[model samples]
Target chain A: MKFNILIFTHATATHYPMNYLASIGSYAIMVREVFKKPTKWRIMKSLILKEIDDLIFGSLGIIIFISFFIGGVVAIQTALNISNPLIPRNLIGFATRQSVILEFAPTFTSIIMAGKVGSYITSSIGTMRVTEQIDALEVMGVNSLNYLVFPKIVAMFFYPFAVAIAMYIGILGGWIAGVFGGFSSSADFVEGLQLDFIPYHVTYSFIKSVVFAFVIATVPSYHGYYMKGGALEVGKAATVSFVWTSVVIIILNYVLTQLMLG
Target chain B: MIEVKDLHKAFDGSPVLKGISTVFEKGKTNLIIGQSGSGKTVFMKCLLGLIIPDSGTICYEGQIYSQLTPEQQRDLRQEMGMVFQGSALFDSMTVEGNVMFPLEMFARQSRSEMQDRVEFVLRRVNLADAHKKYPAEISGGMQKRVAIARAIVMNPKYLFCDEPNSGLDPRTAILIDNLIQEITREYNITTVINTHDMNSVMEIGEKIVFLKDGIKEWEGTNRDIFRTDNEAVSNFVYSSELFKKVRQMYLEERD
Candidate 1:
């Protein structure tokens, strides 16, 4: 029994890293397949439009609501933490702007979308895989990857627009909270918003949004397209896709920050 | 005609199809019948180029599958149609959209022309009123008909059906079988079906191949099946007591 336990532990320890590596290799292959000679432009155009409607337009309301509330909370928290009179009153607004722009809008919002849009992509494709719809495409000689995933990648090009909206709403939310809640004066908040504003920061945020958008689109699609088994497996694939998408986004956030803005 | 030679496949070292060789004739209902684990699905998938065999050759009209370029293979696939067992209709599309899909992908017809073809195929399947209904809203039989209509809309030169009668009542199953047979005759297309339905065998099994454990156990026509003495084939085809009795009566009548 002890020997068996030792073997089991040894096997598991080796399995996880190997599995992760295999997944990364498979994901790279899937990305390559997605860029192969596509279907006719007419068909692809329709698919792209449909994907945009589903992934971008459908996600707007929740993003708006969450961004605004989080921005407000950030401002209030900043105000409460400032006990030193040496710090300027407008510093509350400055801190809120930095946190909302740099982290909340791009990184946190993507983590949320990794749950929402990622699950949808994974479930839809996983269902297709289970029901043999993907097989049907393969039998028909259609490049299933190109047909299914390319449109999603194209649709996520519009994801930055959603991030842009979140940024705007988040700053507006900070304003509403800081002024009405009496955390900071409106004049000081407006001054803080303009203080030390760097144009490169906005560019960096947009760049992060674009990269995160690619993750949200493709990672879930990989899980869905290659999923096997039945309905239960589809749900499992969705959960796994969400976890991996979020983890990748967080890791990429750090790596990109160091490379681009360190 | 489709011909497979010395086909072999293995999944993770467990060989599913050891070596399979068969010829499916053109313009007839060629049925592949076997027990559940007999590698029938794998065989059909190999023929469709959905699964690459570890070692084998599948030839369509004398052109080897592996020798063809990817573009040529795709061009060849356009000539083939398949009806899946579950009637794998796209849930997002209505019956009309499902039928029109292949045409939209391959055919360059105008909107009105596409509409006319879609209507014609739907009418052929006796689904004239089901144009607007989603697959979820329709009966199982209706969904099968819609799948058939979609498969044939492109007027393919080859038709494939995988367990075309599963999950249907006897009456509906027979209807679907007859529809496939009639379509095969009308189009003079090579049609291959994978099924274990004995009823389908006796009704439309013009050329039948029986597989057991991935090996071709027997190959003959429906008429020959009753007379064959192969133990494996006889045991499978006459497993039910009712079928066994019926076979005895059939032989007595023939004598």
Candidate 2:
């Protein structure tokens, strides 16, 4: 049993690296195809507009709701954790601002969007695959990747705008919670929000949001476009897409933070 | 017209299409008939350039497929239209949008001209009233018609149908088959169909190629099929008791 288990483990370890690299290579090829043989602008305009509605507008409600509540929770937790009387009450607002801007609004919200938008991209495209609609596009001599995935990548360029809204709403939630909960004065909370506010931090957050947007759009699309099999497999591909998108985003967040903020 | 010369394909070292040579003529309904796993789909997909044959050449109107540049291949693809087994209508688009998609992609016509073409094709497929309906909103038969309308809206020289009537009822299937035949004759399009439906073979088969184990077992017309004594062909053609009796009657009537 031990010998058999060791062999199985060895086989799996060797296979996954090659498989992972091959998947990345295939993803690069698909992205290249998306740029070639461009769909006519007249038709692509409508497609890009529809995608913006589906991916951007559709995601606003959840991003706002989660950012608000999480902002409140961050303020409350920061207020509770400061045991030293020497520490200023304004630190609660500072903590909320930092958390929401640097991580929550951009990275956290993106992880959530992975579930909402990522699964959607996968299932829609996978369903097209299962029903042979993708094949139909290819048969018509249309670049299926350019037709299906390019519009999505274009619409996600507006994702930073959504993240900016999340940042604003989060600070408001922090203010409301801090003052109303008797944790701090409204004047102090707003003061802390402006205190030492690095303009570059907002830029960094927007930069991260933009990077996450590409990851969100392309990762799910790669899964959906390459997936084979039937209806059951579409559901499976959506789940797998979500996992991979989240993993890539988290890894990218660490790398970006280390480079930009270290 | 399309010509396949010594075509071959295999998956994981197991052959699916093996050294098959055939000619699919223009202005005729050329049917490829076979049982399941007989490489019908693979052969059709190869012809569609969706699959690369392991060996051999597919010449479309004397433009050899493999030798053409990518741009040339894409240009060739625009002149070909295909109807998939599931109709494969874009669920997101209405019937009108589905039919108009090809024109919008490749044609430089004005919006009114494109609209007129869409309307004409929809009317041709008897789907004039269902223009605004989405694929999910309509019945399967109607979706097939929309697919057919889309396939022809670009005015393709070659029309390919992969089991175009698989899920349809007998009456609806026959209507779909007849519609394909009429369109083929009307436009003088080179129509290639992949099917296992004996009804379709008897009805629209101007030329039939029978594949067994990835090899061309027989080649003939629907009428000639009734008289073929090739054991495998006879066994397949008369697999059902009803077909056996019908063939006996056909032979006796000929006698």
Candidate 3:
């Protein structure tokens, strides 16, 4: 039993970074290796095309589907809360615009991506590192860092913008649910929406989405790229990626809001 | 050729490869053999520039490794091929895609030309039909063969295998060993394999290195190994019951 402990401990000692500065250097290494193999996978090209694909084939569904559901629920809830028909019944649509465009679309969709893109990056790279696929790439003269991370990062830069667009489109479904569904009048809802919100708020939403996209894509990859041991380590790295990325998103959102919001 | 001089590698505060020095000859199989945790992997990694040594120099063909630029190092990496223990095939790609990966990265071949080369190498490794299969869909032995095929796909000058026979049965292990040696000889590539299997040492260990507790305890070919009067070598080799019985039978016949 004691012998097992000793061997296990000894095994652990190998995984430690050899120097204090290794942490910083490894990230730079990760960035380079992930980005290096541009031509091999048609990575740069694929990134642009994938965003188009996500926009046209896939992401719109998420926005429309989520918005309609949320909008329907909001309409039902607001209909009951309002007793006075004389008051501005269009307050619901005005409130919906801020929630959907400023907060819900960008922040909520990013949370969704934390599950999709985040898990994919972490597991794929973590598996590659553990199974010696990354080492294989290294020996083959392929810059694993450049090859792996570049496509992911470039893809990330655009994916959130598309997602933000999706979320913005999604809020319209909610808007129609209020006005066309008789919960609120069309003129009042339209007037209420245009008058109350900042157009620059859309810019903030896009910027925030871009920021969230980076954190989601890179942090998960960082955890996976340095994964040691085997399948178990890959699993642990994926789990840790989720936890750390969630924490980073919250922290980054708070910071960006404070710094970017006028 | 690769020369590792006074290599000192440690894990946390304790040492794994402690001031080890060795040379691997060009155009021959250099076998580094040891039990698990004997630092053979570290030595191999150090030579390949995967891990940096604390206070030693790795001279690859007399060029100090650490001094090379990233591009030069990447170009240098093109000169070598590696076969990992897990066979490390890219799960997302087909076998042809896996073989074509290095070539696509380093060479300026057209798509059809690359396809031709991939087929040629796949044929060479007797994997002509497995080109379209994903790695997970293949058998373990087949995966190792695909790995070997991928390693040699680039026609590399040097080859490194980390426990080439790790998870295979005895027959499969011997087959992989012979394939490696045959490929090494055919290409005259400097082949280094890190393994603990005695079967490998006796079978194709043209120039063998025995590492114990991170030290080079013995270095010899299979022919000289049986006759050497070194106790550490004898203890390690003859500790196997199968080896002991075989040795006794040979001795009895000699008498």
In lDDT terms, which candidate is top? 2
Better of 1 and 3 by DockQ: 3
Note each model's CA RMSD in angstroms.
Answer: 4.8, 4.8, 4.9
Residue B246 in model 2: lDDT: 90
Q: Report the C-alpha lDDT of model 3 over B1-255, residue by residue, as the tens digit.
A: 888788898866688888888888877888998777889988888777777677788878877877887678777888888999889888888998899888777778788988888898888777889988999898888899899988998888889998999889999899889999999989888899998888998899889988889888889898777777888888887888999787777667767
| lDDT string, candidate 3, A39-82, tens digits | 55464476456644643345556655766666556655665587
The Cα error of candidate 1 at residue B234, in Å, is 0.8
| Per-residue lDDT over B17-85 for candidate 1, one digit per residue giving the tens place of the 0 to 100 score | 989999998889999999999999988988887777889899999999889987888888888999998
- What DockQ score does model 3 reach against the true complex? 0.49
What DockQ results do all the predictions give, each relative to the true complex?
Answer: 0.42, 0.46, 0.49
Model 2: residues with Cα > 4 Å off, grouped in runs: A1-18
Query: Pairing residues by index, what is the TM-score of model 1?
Result: 0.96
> TM-score: which is higher, 2 or 3?
2
Model 2 alpha-carbon miss at residue B7, Å = 1.2
Better of 2 and 3 by DockQ: 3
